[model samples]
Target chain A: MGHLILRVTIKILFAPIILFAFYVQFHGDYGPGGGFQAGVILASAFILHALGFGLATCQKVIPPNWLPAGMALGVLIYAGTGIYTMLFGDNFLDYDVIQPDSHHHAGQHIGIIAVEIGVGLAVACTMLQIFYAFAGREPEPMDDAW
Target chain B: MMLAAAASAEVGSEVTPSTPEVVGFTGAFAVELCLLALLAATAVAMIRMRRLFGVAMLSGIYSLLSAAFFVALDAVDVAFTEAAVGAGMSTVLLLSGIALTAKVEMPVSRTRTIAPLIIVGVTAAALVYATIDMPGFGDANAPANAYVGRAYIEQTPSDIEVPNVVTAVLASYRGFDTFGETVVVFTAGLACLLLLGAGAIRGGGRNDDGEH
Candidate 1:
């Protein structure tokens, strides 16, 4: 029989973990979090799900095929922001000219948020992808064979 | 930067002709010491343990203690990162790796162990010597505090206008550095995928056993 209690517990806990990750992602400007922490937090929920259920079950939720896209997209989003700033005649990743003729704070704020989103996506996907890789491998005989 | 300015103002108000009271063996210090002791114990236990499973758990405990210590030091961001990466990701990864190999640690010859011990001893001594020249804790006159730190604190409001100085410094002032770090993280992930992702990433069956 499945560990029904553990399964139920995971089911109940999943949404809140994702919610908390979003809160950390956005609240980073005021508090002690950022894209890095948020992304890890987000991916960890899936890991937890994998533990409670199984890898195959978790893969159904977040397909292994899409993980590569998630990983690359994050970098693209981040570098794209820098490239956008350059197009505006500003230094690479410079937020001052992101929203030209607008409030500098607004520009800076938007730039930070965008960059953080990119970071969050990259981190979350990479972590989950790594988990998939490690978990998918079948056990092998040790070299000593003791 | 408002938060940062308030902090600077608070620090300014505390400065007086009288010398500031030195923090002694307060409760926080006691907590810090306890965490440090636990961390050291965990590390030693992890090293000594023959069971790789227990070693992985102990390492996770070490990371947890380090995160607690960071929180005590008011570096909540660092603590958050430590808890996420070390406790969350690394422990899981290590356990997965252990599943693919022997649970018991391979016995090494005593002679082979001596080289690592001497290396660690020499490195620890050098680190202790390095700490001797460092400024005392909370020393406002410290080079990092007296100049660049203050400039960031004061100018953040006028420049990027983010309230969290750490965020402002990381995201705006040294944004290019953060960009590079993101790319590094991406590169590491790509490398891992390249190495271990064949079975998982390919369309159908995985592993030598051909489990899909």
Candidate 2:
């Protein structure tokens, strides 16, 4: 069937992109890869899936109502890290001061990863949501003046 | 502080520095130049094309080529955003708009062609002139790296504790800019929602019957 072939092709194309995204996120310290690039790559993979499959299928995967919540959650996670630092008797986003007794270096790395994950989540979800919104809807008519 | 530590380590390294193999730089340069030429050619083609859909697709290619240029410059974040927004989102929106209006592009007139050509020529000349006195590409010790970037590398870790300098700069030192960017994203979402909501309502009213 047409749907089966499409699904197989989609999986083939998407698997590598997802793997590469994880590589970019983790290997950013060594080279030119980072959270943003990883996020976009992941988002593009999903957008491609949405394009190939029907918009209804895409909606089932990422419902419109869930998208706003995801975006807010991502922003909150990022802001929450800063708030944690602030509450621990330091300036906002001062990860070194997170835990005075523990090794500060470990804490800093944890904090950076947390924030990067938040950014990645926000960007990926927002991009997919935008594509869904645009592609799922039909167009309006032109003005009657003509 | 990390950069300084790295720099100090570099000073005492026993290994001799050598250019890492980056494929064929000449071939890469030739390909990049060809892409740039293709971008320009496509822009002209888009203008001359009689079909609006073709123009939109050509413009999308132009955006993608610019994104490739950004990647070649090692600006991955910018390239990501451009590929998503400019190439992906804008093209979709433009096509949707065209679907709502006329499907064909308006015929080009001599008056329109002359103005755009002159504008493009003047802009290109200015850019060429500006690049003449610029430092060579990828110069590590260029003014950009020496001054503006140096401060962030030196001070941010001690203060913000983020190993990634770009993240530290965007989220902490330049937090206001990030805030502004968030607002821009929110505003765009709001505008799209409003516009799309109106369209949906009108579409529904027109199609009260279940039949297409």
Among all candidates shown, the one with the greatest lDDT = 1
| C-alpha lDDT (0 to 100) for residue B86 of candidate 1 | 89
Candidate 1: the clashing residue pairs are B1-B162, B1-B163
| Residue A116 lDDT, candidate 1, scale 0-100 | 90
The residue-by-residue lDDT of candidate 1 on B49-140, one tens digit each, is 88989988876787777788778767788899999998878999999899888898778878887776666566555555665566666678
Model 2: runs farther than 4 Å from truth? A1-7, A26-30, A100-104, A142-146, B1-28, B74-101, B116-119, B151-176, B198-212
Evaluate all candidate structures by whole-model CA lDDT and list the values in order. Answer: 0.80, 0.62
TM-score on alpha carbons, each prediction? 0.89, 0.72
Model 1 chain A: ten consecutive residues of lowest lDDT: A137-146
| Model 1 ranges off by over 4 Å | A143-146, B1-22, B203-205, B208-212
How many collisions per candidate? Answer: 2, 0
